[model samples]
Target chain A: MNWNQIRTVYGKEMRDALRDRRTLLSMLLVPALVIPGIMFAFTAVSLKVVKKAAEETPAVMIIGPGNSEPLQKALAGSPKLRLVPAASDYAQQISDKRIRAAVEIPPGFEADLAANSIATVKIYTYEGEMKSSFAAGEIDRILREFREAAVTRKLGERGLNASFVRPFEIKRQNVAPPEKVGGNLFGGFVPYLLIILSVVGAMYPAIDLTAGEKERGTMETILCSPVGRVELVLGKFLTVLTISLSTVVTSITSMALSAVGLVHLFAGKVGAGAKAVNAATGQQLPMVDPVGVLGVMVMVLPLAVVFSALLFSVSLFAKSHKEAQTYASPILFLTILPAMAAMLPGVELNAKLALIPVLNVSLIGKEMVSGSFRYDMMALIFGSSCLYGAAALAVAVRLFNRESVLFRT
Target chain B: MIEAEGLTKVFRDKKRVEVRAVDGVSFRVEPGQIYGLLGANGAGKTTTLRLLATLLKPTSGAATVAGFDVVRQAHEVRKQVGFLAASTALYGRLTARETITYFGRLNGLGDPEIAVRTRRLTEELDMGEFIDRRTDKFSTGMKQKVSIARTLIHDPAVMIFDEPTLGLDVLAARTIVRFIRDCRERGKTVIYSTHVMSEVEKLCDVIGIVHGGRIRAEGTLDALRARFGQRDMEEIFVAAVGGESALARQDVPPATTR
Candidate 1:
């Protein structure tokens, strides 16, 4: 192979691709601006919606207001729930979302408690509606407090303390560090985006360099040169790899900056409300580890090569740019499915899974981001990815060498 | 020098039908001589030139260019030959100088050599006005000039042009015809293929009348006219390929179009 010729081809292709607006959009603009823009928009909207749902005071109707005057007074006195007048069509009102929930205090409910008898209070709500659900939860909390006070009064009558009913306490805590917590939370997501971005980044240039040349009638001119087919393929492959890696880096940088900016904005604006929002959603703002992120980027290298080679090989079968896109669509979907499979809950990477192409990279990337390094698995994944990349490159070279494929009508 | 001993190329279509694109073609052209292979659209003229240029390997038979076997030493053959087809195009995004320099480098020329060749080709082809401009916006004539410069950048010993003036305007076509003549003046072995009888009469030192993937007649314009008992070159071509009826049977219009 002629290294000089390869460099010549690579340099020319890179310059050509840079001048192309389509390649620039996919490799730089989309990953750097569009992705982070969508992420920021989605996060801001969801947080705002959650916070609104938590803060809204919803109206509730008492079905038997006269039978439990004290209970009605207590419900009306609470700040979270607004007691509405007695109504027979409480279910209809809840369904219409006019009233958040309805509390049915049974007849003689206080007399049953006074006689130490069991009575059930049914709270009706609009299922699956966020505001209604919040209202129902507040009503339930107040009812539970009233019942506990009654129990305490009963204990006082028996000359006993409230501690007699409770034997021990249970507490829960997380042992993992914040970085691991963040990694575990965003691990599946980050790798999935990076893998997809890498593939997307390589797509246009691969199609443009191979099939685009054929359509433009430049393939014959280049074929007549002294450079070998293998060298030419290598040159083109390296160009695609460079664009693919650049896309991933741009996306990572954009996402990191967006994450930091959003974190700071949330801290400054909502302060404790952000924590309340996180607690309500069972998610915390993740603290990304710079070193761990670097590790993930390192692991993505071989996989990027694999995507570049595979895309090039597939696009070479097409005779035009449009046809090349058709040929490459299936490959994009195939990679996506495996990357998504790695994101499923309980889908941990095993020895066998480490040999799979996109899935292995995604799974291992998650671990790397979480500050965990299973070197054996990492080596296995890296080696297997390299093998796949080499094989795909061989296929590209072989296809490029075939006159029938190159000059197909 | 260039030589072909029964060079042939076969292809199979999508329906599994076999096609002899080039069949048992034999010819020779010495340095400084212009050999024109004249044929209609699908008479395997392009295939023959492609085989000689090492763009496509011959299915049967053998050929040599510049003392190297086309099949066994394709890389060497490519290094020694400059090929330009009418369909061949330039990289639209590259400047004319860059395009020429790129091919020079691909041919293993050093930086100093490429720079010198780029300047000379630019001057020779009258491309100085657009040498530093991207080729996408150039006129057909200007682009053709750049393509010629790129083809000759390596200073190869043999030049193969396959219908290089197919779709050019009169001025552009004249430039290409002049370039072919210039190549021969420089002692380059030139094989020019076309279906135009006037080009053959005016340019080729030796002419090969090709029909159905085989050369039916081979000689100078005068020799062919004498041997076929025809005064006009087109009549000589028509008679050499078989007769008027054979041309009719092949579904080809008379060679008067281009």
Candidate 2:
């Protein structure tokens, strides 16, 4: 009951936990490195695939050979493209994945060009194939270029300069706050993913430290000492909370750095966002700030602390590592339903949402990533998280005090 | 003095069928005496011990530890009663001194008082060598000594050791036996439970033999022996249970009780 007792228990436990390497790795090392690494890798791989596929022109068979030469020339220069002779049964080949697409150019050939007519070319592709849409888009782009070339040629034939063939070019740009920019690039994912990571990061340690002590038959000794249940719970809860929040903060830093390709390790998970026009040498766009990065981290840390305490409470009931995990897995399922609420885009984080603990925090986290900030909402998250943390810790202490739970075997 | 008057404890389960763990147990031990409650597993020795320790509330009847009601004055009882159970292990992460100091504080001793008590208990229990060492490094006998130190830390007037030598090797057991005797010499009231007849004969000044949720016999070892008209205490124990052989069967761990 005394502060000294709480301090003693807390000090000893923290020292022991800090010395334990597995606790450190689970709570800090893994989250600080692995999560960001996985996210960056995912982002990088996806970005590469998208960019590569966007530039490629998969083989297209011009069925009618109506306007084949210029389209073939445009596709030939692209390495991602190939030109194949039309099969007698191109239909079967398309279904069998032999060719990416078959283009049906109307049979008019040169007549359509001389008539200044609106020509139509049909591009055939199987639905939902990798790079298939790219091939179709390339065909469309080719058709547009061909129309411009034909008009210019016709004007030249009449001795005009054909200046009207392409009078202007279209340019697109983005103006968003760095965090929002970060979010836009990898925004929705950061909040929810970090929340999960923070909670998950604390899971093993909380269980190992609190419940593990009981299973090992050491808690009674510890508790029978001058330490009261409240002090013991507080000390352990704070350790778990510290470790969990540290992981979140580290993830936030890693995600931010990786968002700009400053760290290649997690480039795939949170790749570079839209490049800004430098206007100096017309090089690649500048790596701007990511979208809604702050909000995601702010919201996820509380959730992480709540889950850490909760998992610790349950884990303490388990008698062994295997037994702890058995209960922990079900608890993991408990988290999933609440966490899934965050993935719902456009769901409002109302006052009701903040009262529900995990799901509410998740909703707040998602809202944060969307660059939405409410001071009251923030206070609710912090308050409720701490309250849940205290409650879960009380449950853990109750389990500690119960001889039946500790000696379940 | 300590007293349990017709104290009974019935552990209720989800099923309505009731199985009494302890029933109609009554006894008294004066200060400066070691009272042994001898019973095999499920004989309610532990339940009686728990009720006396204020850890479990008795279902019926009443008991008091050091003039404080076990249930209503649990905090007061805890303040005066020092409990050492086989189930309680020392904090491996803490030094023996730290462990004893902790319990002393819990018993409401001020900082200086706890420090004085910690030093005296550790020294008296022969824990001086490893009192500063973390419990994780202590040998089995050493841990038991530290556990004894923790129990005595508060300088409680009443001390209860429940199967305290359990899982302990002979050397550790001997140290505990000596410690119990030492408590008696110091004029402390002791409630020590064990089915170990040798321990009872050698250590208990007054003994209570329990069976089937009640005390079957209570007296001096010689008196108990004479009651059954047996020369050997083991025979007296066997004869006390008559033909049931319940005492012999209960030595098997509770897990084997099919």
Candidate 3:
């Protein structure tokens, strides 16, 4: 295969792809804007909605509170939950969502506390209801604080300090750097999206270059040229690879920019300041080192090639652009399986997992974004992916060279 | 200089049922001569041209284009042959000049050489008016001109035209007929295919009547007429294809009239 011939084919295909409005839309504009736009809308809208829902004064009904005036006073004193009059049909009300929650105190609530016996406080809430759950949580906290106050008061009456009962304290601290913490939390899905975007980006171009040529009647002309099949296929492959890589870069960059934009937009008003910025958006912001991100992009190359080759092979089997699309649709789901596998928890980048195709890339990519560069595993993943990519490319080249497949009516 | 020695192509569908699309078809065309393969649709005319152009491998026998073996030296064969189909299939997204230049470069011409050839072909094909415009909006004639220019950009020694004027208008078909004659004048061996008997009589220096994947008759127009005792090329073609039984229904007068 002559490299010059390959370059010629590559240049022409690139020109064609650039000129095709459909290709441009699917490959560049959609990836670059869609993810970030979805992220922005979800972040900006959900932040306001969740905040508004949380701040609403949810009314709670306290039952059997007359037996314990202190408990009733404790529930009423809390600012987060408003104490509503006890109702005979509070259970029905909670189920209907008219009331957030209901608290039922046992008949001997005060006597049990005085005798130093354990007393159980039952809280009823609409399960799976966000607002009701939040209210239930507040009521639980108020009862715990009330118990602590009672214990302290009794201890002080006995002329003892509260520390006597509580000998030690447990405090949790996150030792990971902010970048690593963010990477670990948010980097899990980056590999999945990268794999999906790389496949999607290469999809249209690969089909256009192969099946599109046949449909346009240009395939016969190209086949009649002096360039060998290997050269032609490789040229088309390179174009697809370029498109896939650019898409990965553009969409990832767009996502990062949108994250920064969202952080800046709602920083102070919604407590989306530094502390809550990452947590507020359901998706963790990817804050890994630039070098790590670069390394991850590099790691994505072989997988991109794999996707390009597979798409090329499948599309070439189709006789027309429309048929090629039909042939290629199932591959999207096939790719998503491995990508989604990488997103699953406990699927770490071990030696065994490195041998799997898309899943391995996802695992290593996740690690790279999380500020954990396991060179040994990275090498394994890269080398294996290259082998798989080459194998897939060889299949594509063989398909291109096949007379039966190419000239099928 | 093109030769086919019993070249054959067999196709097998998914059920493994074999159909011989081109069965032992053989013909030869000398330099500066236009050899026309005259056959009806589905008679393997396109398959024969494709075989000569190295687009398909012969299941048996061999063919050569400009003395390069279609099977073993397929790349060399492609280098010396320019194949055009009936569709006038130019890349719609590319300008006429861009399409010519792209094919020229693929055939190993450098940029400067491609530019020279592109300009010469454009002027020769009289496509200057729409040379720079994207071909998607081009008329049928304009697109055919672009396809012709693209085919000749590399100046190959053997040219293959598989019914190049099938869907063209009268003017477009006239342009292609003139182009085929010009190729002959330029000393390029041309293999043209069409079912139109008048086209064969007008242009072909030699005619090969192909039917059912085999050549049934081969000779110049006059020679075929003299051999078959038929003055008309259509009758000569009918006789060459199947003799009396196939033509008795179409060419013969009614028995009552006789």
TM-score of B-chain for each predicted structure, in order: 0.95, 0.93, 0.93
DockQ of each: 0.57, 0.37, 0.46
* lDDT for each candidate structure: 0.88, 0.72, 0.84
What is candidate 2's lDDT per residue for A1-409, written digit by digit as tens? 5677666666666766776778778766776687667876786687678666655667667675535565657655656557788667777787876777877877775677678776777778887987776677667777777777778888889888776655687776655544454433444455556666776767777787766776666664554343555677777777777777777777667666655564555444223333322452344432323344565565566667668777887887776677778877876777777777666666667788778877777666555665666779879877887787667766777766665564454
| Candidate 3, B1-258: lDDT as tens digits | 998998988877557777777889878899999999998776788878888888888899998888989999998988898888874377888898899898889888889998888888878888889999999999988988888888888899999999888878899999999999999999999999998999999999999987777788999988999999999998998888776566443321111100
lDDT of 3 by residue, A251-336 (tens): 88888888788778877854543346456433344366667777878888898888899999999988888999998889899889
Estimate, for each residue in A214-323, the C-alpha lDDT of model 1 and write its tens digit: 88988888999898999999999999999999988988888888878887877655567757757865656565567767877888898889889999988888889999
Off by over 4 Å in 3: A115-118, A153-165, A270-287, B243-258
Better structure of 1 and 2 per lDDT? 1
**Cα deviation of A31 in candidate 3 (Å)?**
3.3
Worst 10 residues of 1 chain A by lDDT: A280-289
Interface RMSD of 3: 8.4
> Over the stretch B1-258, how does candidate 2's per-residue lDDT look in tens digits?
799899987765445446576888899999999999887777778778777876666789999888989878766777787788787776676778776766676566778988887777766777778877888888899888888877887778999888888888988899989989989999999999997989999999898987877788889988987788877767777777654567656542231010
Please give, as one word, the docking class of candidate 2: acceptable
- 2 or 3, greater by DockQ: 3
- Displacement of residue A93 (Cα, Å) in model 2 is 7.6
